[model samples]
Target: MKVLHVITGLGVGGAEQQLRLLLRHLPARCEVVTLTHPGPVADGLRADGVPVVHLGMTGNRDLSALPRLTRLVRAGRYDLVHTHLYRACLYGRLAARLAGVRAVVATEHSLGETQTEGRPLTAGVRALYLAGERLGSTTVAVSPTVAARLRRWGVPASRIEVVPNGIDLARFRFDPVRRHRTRRRLGLPDDAFVVGGIGRLVPGKRFDVLVRALARLPGDCRLLLVGGGPDEHVLRREARRAGVADRVLLTGERPGLPDGSPGPDLPSLACAMDVLASPSPEEAFGLAAVEGLASGLPVLYAACPALEDLPPHTAPAARRVPCGDEEFGRALAEVRAAGPGPRTAPEAARHYCITRSAARLMDVYATALARQSLSPAPQGVSSA
Candidate 1:
């Protein structure tokens, strides 16, 4: 089937990266439309031979792009239009309906209990999101906790589908040789105790807490902050203020490989470290934590509903801790004292492979198509 994916932007965030990975495994004839900021991910998709159209949406209030998007949808003759992120969900649903496409689906990849994207969920935002949600056939939630949150926000339980975010396990598998190589490339000492955190440098991620925790640890410990965002300067200032700037290493956003590979060898970075820490209190799905587990490292996270929802056998190496510097430091000490524990990385990541996620998504697509076949199109509908 012909499918078109609509997203807010193609920046190097969780949702954007997940979409790039999903396209690698999906069988449908797929194309992409980015509303704005067609960044590195866009280049990677094009290198992989996927057509990407950039709609130069000046801002959120640029309604003129609606007709342009609708025209593109009609011209493409797509059987399905799937939307990701907030702005795309809002405009893509409307555009798909205008183009007379009946099979439209959206994925909610970044919603938490109290925040949408590091901001409080105001009433106006909820109303707008709910209005957009009504135009789609189904909404895919990335986790059970997010599904529950959608229901609480007034979305019908029947309309929500829980599909966990997946990782390419082969790319993240543990390799001692690669681990040593990565450590040397990053200029890290062989015997240093490294604690790594991966995510956009946003306020909600709480990287400052991690910096403070590093200060509270012993002299040989260090912090590695991966990914970049608006708060990079703020985090650097925080590290300096905490007197741990010397121990904190920040690698600003790394580009994907030029060959359009599925991953950036994140597992190599994870393997180079002794432990992984995720202190974000508003995670929809802890992708980094899962990758760390798959890399055979103990993970300490503050809030990961996805990990908690899974069976104990799935990720036995993940431990939950309170959200504070002292608690995080204490947990780190305990984990270091206990050593690496068991080698459950491969088993823990078995359930979250990208191939499995792609099959489940195809199932969702088939279900939507079947439901559409049973319903009659409304009369007097016109393409915009």
Candidate 2:
């Protein structure tokens, strides 16, 4: 079936990247509509041969976006409308209905305990979310933790589907040659213990905690804060304040796509690291930690519902720690003393392979379309 995906923007983030990855794996004929800022991911999607449209939404109050998106949806004649992020969900659902498509689905990719898409859970936000939710047929949560959050927000359990964020395992598979090469290219010392903190440089992500934790670690320990955002300057300032500025590396917004798009890509960076640390106390799914696992790096996370939902035996090296510099600093010291273990992805990493996530999402798609059809479930992406 034909599908159209609507998202707030095509910026480089978990949800944007995940949507691009899913389009690569999902079976349906698909096109994308980004409400604003058709940045790198949109460029990447176009390069990958997906048609994308920029709606040029001015702001949240741009009511004109609704009619424009509706027109695009109608023109596409898509069988289903899949929306991602908050703003897109609000507009995409309304546009899909205006365009006469009933099979609408929105994936909740970043709903923390008290935040949705980095915004505080105000009464107005919750109410608007619920009202827009009614326009969609299904809400896919990236983790059970997020699913629970949605239920608590008054969405019916039956309306929620759990489709975990997935990774491209082959892309993240540890490569000794790449690791050595990447380390040299990035000026990392051979004996230096590299600690990776991968995520947007955001306040809620609490990357500052890692910056401070670096101050307490040995001089040989280096902090590589991957990804970028508004909090980048703040993180750099914190590094300076902590007196570890010389040892901190900030590679701004590398897609790290296994597709060989650019240098210092995520997989190569992953190979160069000895361990991964995520200090963010709020996460719907700790995707970076999983990627770290795929790279065979031990991970220390403040909160990871993705790992918490899984059996502990699946990923023994991944540990949950308190969201404080002192606590995380001790964990890093302990890991460094132990030295690096095997550089091989565990079962937990395999469980979230991109293909598996695609298959599961197809099931959700088929079910949603079936309800609209009032007939046998529609065929979706192949499990193979």
The estimated TM-scores of all candidates read: 0.96, 0.95
Per-residue lDDT of candidate 1, residues 189-249 (tens digit): 8888899999999999998889998888888888988888999999899899989889999
Clashing pairs in 2: 256-266
**Candidate 1 segments whose C-alpha is farther than 4 A from its true place:** 341-346, 376-384
Candidate 2 overall Cα lDDT vs. reference? 0.90
Minimal lDDT window, size 10, model 1: 375-384
| lDDT of every predicted structure (CA atoms) | 0.86, 0.90
Residues 118-184, candidate 2: write the lDDT tens digits: 8998999989999898888999999999998899889999999999988989889999999999999
Clashes of 1: 0
**Which portions of model 2 miss their true places by more than 4 Å?**
255-264, 374-384
Question: What is the Cα root-mean-square deviation between model 2 and the actual structure?
Answer: 4.6
